[model samples]
Target chain A: MLKGETETELEYANMHYFFNDNTIITAGKFLLPFGQFGANLHPSWINKAVSNPGIYGGHGGNGSLGGVTSIMNDTGINVANTWVLGDAGRIFTDFYAVSGPRQEEGDHGGGVEIESKKGDNNDSMAFGGRIAYAFLPEWEIGMSYYSGAYSDDGDLNYSAYNIDFNWVGSYSSVRGEIFGSTAETEGEEEGEEEGHGEEWVKDFDKSGWYIQGTWQARQLGKSWLNPVEFVVRYSDIESDFDGSIEHDFEEDGGKTGSRIYYGVNYWLEPSAVLKLGAESTSIDNEEASHTSVPDDRIFLQLAFGF
Target chain B: MKSIKFVFTIIVLTTSAFSIKAQHVNDPSLVAKGAKVYSENCARCHNARPAEEYSKKEWSVVIPHMRAKAHMTGKEALAVEAFLASTLTADVRHAEEYTKPNAPKKSGAELVAQFGCQGCHQIKGEGGKLGPNLDGVVANKGEAFLLKKLIDPKFNNAASAMPKYPMNKDDVKAIIGFLKE
Candidate 1:
């Protein structure tokens, strides 16, 4: 799931049914079961950085470091289940089918948006699933894959995969995810003016990853300092599509560069947190058009869950 | 703006409280289990949401959404529901000062139950198996170790899923005393 795409209005509404302890079926609009950040850690109380990985932007954004990936919520039906493997291990799975990507139109035209929020432009539906394994009770690793038609003509297609892992120790935690994707698109030289203009077909590829670490300030001694946490994350995304319509791909977080984020968070209580963070981003593609260059930033925020 | 927000919070909490009392449950063990699950699972993503933030109906919608997204077991979802319900039925206001300074003295057993230690630590052959058995842990680990662990569960292991409780000397001593018995 992506952050910038979230609307202040109803984010999503879905109903789920449990067939058993290990199986559940959900219908209607819901969050995309993509990577750890979109599916899990996007919530303010949980995410360590004030800003998400630039590569995870969905749409409506042209962050200098943005790259087209995917959205956070869409109209879909998903089934999830868990299997306890003996006493020490477990397997978890989530599968879904939904309105896939749509060809971008209007201001930034020629590319794909990666989510059919207005509903699927084509009759074809998208499909995806994630499988994960848990061991040592506190450690987990997962793999996810998604594929579907993204064009109104249903001839153009997009596919992506993500690998993620998480581990929790008494005083620290580590988690991260890697996402890679490719898409086929056609734009007339003039992007397609009937039979009058030559056709250009591009096989665009993009990929990115982020790793985060957090350490609890337990050894710091003061009981009042016990709730403090130090966190750091690194992220990068790259793309091969150098189309003239750079904004179209950048809307989906397709800009190529790397970012480093470091922060500290203090828990006012179990349900409230105060955060101080700083981020530095480096851009690689000088040809990409952006209103402003990707810049380093510092921020402070208070997030209360109640 | 602050006044409006506070009023909104109050109205939501008050309405949810009414619904919770109608179906109030007093099962400490279930609440304990819910407490443990809520922290261990939910904390990984963000701060724990206060139970009164949602009505039972809202939680009905939220829990299932999370259950599917997080791949949580049905049992855990139910445990969290029970925990939230128990909290909503509580008379205490969320904005009220927490853990009052002049709180009445509680028995070590009460402290143990309040902290939900048995939810993870095996206690007299009962409770969970995630943490080490606490049946005779006082004698085995020594009082000093237990005291440190209580204040900072990560004192011994950085990755311990065990939560910390910053208790004053009296409460820590009482917890250790109860473990010895």
Candidate 2:
């Protein structure tokens, strides 16, 4: 359980039973393995930068418009396995069924609400899978797909796809992910009165991507400075929707912005890090004439994991 | 009194056996298997770190955490632990040695001799004939050039056959000082 200033939450509660060396079955709420960033870098100590990239943070109001969000967890069951291929490297796969996300009332601090909790809201079950191949010791590529109903009435549906890659070298590392999603909104016809009307469905598209790189100071032959690392990241998100759709979308239509982050991480130890960085965000709102001004900010964080 | 003594002996023997089992592995086949498992499983997400990078105690914590992320079975995790325990001995015995307040500082000439520079290059007319004489190389090439060569000879001379030394900044400075003298 995680305790915060305003709320107490259970981050992950699960049970796993390993059937053998190659297979394991898990039941409970687990962090969704939708992409590399959500699974591998969500932990404060593991992430190199002080703040998450715009795409992965699930902030900036972009994900609400059918874009990919950094889903926290899903109440479900998962089966995962790893297969070794000798010289060709290995492959890891996860197959899961879960209760998918439900849209919240309004935006909270620019963050979208697409994470499902313990209680079930929809009768339909969502199913998806993630497949990753480590072609080499230092390189890996993964692909993920998830689809399900988005509304209690089941008129609205969404499907998301993600492709991610990670490469590590002796002195440098690079990670990147790109995702695209589509949501269909079924609207009632204007002519019909009261609660009865013809249903009209419209599809919206959302997509985002980010690439980050980190260089270790030891590459300069300064082993004493091995704890210091330089990091840089660039990210962008775009959400396109039909203005006629009867949804409370942002005034700017949806979050359409790009961000660049420059930072350095100092490791107090292998498990702890102090991060300092600056972030600049640029919004390309189609209705920029009336949209709020964009601002740049500095980031500072101290994170550790025991 | 006799029963108490027998129970104490049993406890002492069992504790010793458990302690020995936990400390290190002596089986060569298990160690080899562990080495292979460590290399294959740990290298998937990140670079494989050398065992000497962390203390045995540190590994005790790191291994279990990574086991969950990598989805390793209990037996596989144990094998990997055994491999690291058998091979990755700590480089420093004690933390104090790293920050020894009164540790004797070696002189420039002593640093040169420690690195065996005299084996290839001559300083003040005493050394080998494999490389150019360093008697005036410092004056002719400049301190910056000499420093670079010392760190990496091939950077200047592509065909150079000199081996690179893993010297820190202070060691490089001391070697330069000895060459100037």
Candidate 3:
């Protein structure tokens, strides 16, 4: 070991009763020269079946909370050690309706801004894990799998599963994820066909896979007076599904997105840096074929390490 | 038309009054405020000296920390900010000095200065009782965690009696750099 010194660190933060219906708790610990790893847990206080419209894909009633636990290692292995491995796992109850929100959709905590929706909460559970290893200092490859459940407003049931391979490198990282699902709808009542109450409908199971990648680069110390650095990156994902959920949900064969970022890091002193960047991403989903909504973002950051 | 004008005047006056009231109070001159608060409230249980005479970043971390531990109010805390800002070095105003072909090597005093390692504990190879001795600290606590401990002690040990230091980012980095060297 090229011994200078090494140490371990652990940190935790918790916030309860956020937005009147949710609680969040997180914990992290790292071993020196190794990197850091942590876990995040969210528990809901309301019933998912009949909660808010946007709470859990309608069909909301009482629901259980779920969470994601991850372990990441930065491997101080350096050029000599060369190879590193990262592993993580996530487990949840009623995950289809809850976990999907945090991963596939936009953030709910838009600060002071609030959006409202309605529907009964769905019930489901999901669990999965991933393991990846770096063969070269600039590249890594790995795989992951997850499975969960989905429940209708009535006592109907549905299940979902996902598997994927990941490749990571110094300038870019890519992942290919395959997903599938099965569902059974409740039948409508005899007199209320329009309401579709108690009506049981079955859709062919659906499955598909998509691939995404992100790339980055940086430049530093261009001039003594100006002394600035630059960084840029891009990413995308696409998948296909066999069925649709009427006006609420649809199975698009796939979707594609492209993003661009440009930034500068200005060093004011040996210990401080001021960063500014502009970013934009465009996406075309299979279901929303005509609408092109590309997102643009801008930001400024001032950081000091001393 | 006359009634509308009258109401508009009233609204303008009310709005101005509220804005004036909402303005934060600058109760004291900026200099010495952070130190004053530290000596008056925090110094009793914790040592008042800067950790190895930490940089602006170190102070930034330590200062905000006094809030949760000492229960200092928002207004009272602003005064502390002014004091520390004045003492610490300015922003990355001199980037070239760092990236230069031959930057000066760190002197012993400068090393001690940044780490403020002697502030709470002893070095050479022994110093204070307020915290553990550093001779053993460097062995297990690499430069990173040590710097983290200086700025945010509670993160390392929730039960630690050590309070956070409110130094800004640069000062923390400066201290961290020195320790690493």
Clash number for model 3? 72
Candidate 2 off by > 4 Å: A1-8, A58-67, A106-112, A192-197, A248-253, A286-290, B1-26, B32-65, B71-76, B87-181
Tell me the docking grade of candidate 3: incorrect
Give the C-alpha miss distance for residue A152 in model 1, angstroms. 1.2
State how far residue B144 of model 2 sits from its true place (Å): 23
Q: Rank by TM-score, descending?
A: 1, 2, 3
Using TM-score as the measure, which candidate wins? 1
Worst lDDT run of 10 residues, candidate 1 chain A, spans A57-66
Against the unseen true structure, what C-alpha lDDT does each candidate score?
0.69, 0.64, 0.34
DockQ, candidate no. 1: 0.18
Candidate 1 regions exceeding 4 Å error are A1-9, A58-63, A187-200, A242-254, A290-294, B1-39, B48-65, B80-115, B120-174
On the 0 to 100 scale, the lDDT of residue A62 in model 2 is 21
What TM-score do all the candidates reach, one by one? 0.73, 0.67, 0.31
TM-score of chain A, all candidates = 0.88, 0.88, 0.39
Worst 10 residues of 1 chain B by lDDT: B89-98
Which segments of model 3 are wrong by more than 4 Å?
Answer: A1-125, A135-139, A150-229, A239-244, A250-256, A267-273, A285-298, A301-306, B1-181
Judged by lDDT, which candidate is best?
1
Evaluate residue A185 in candidate 3 and report its C-alpha lDDT on the 0 to 100 scale: 37
lDDT of 3 by residue, B7-85 (tens): 5336544543443211222232433333344333332222234323566566556554444223344443555555444
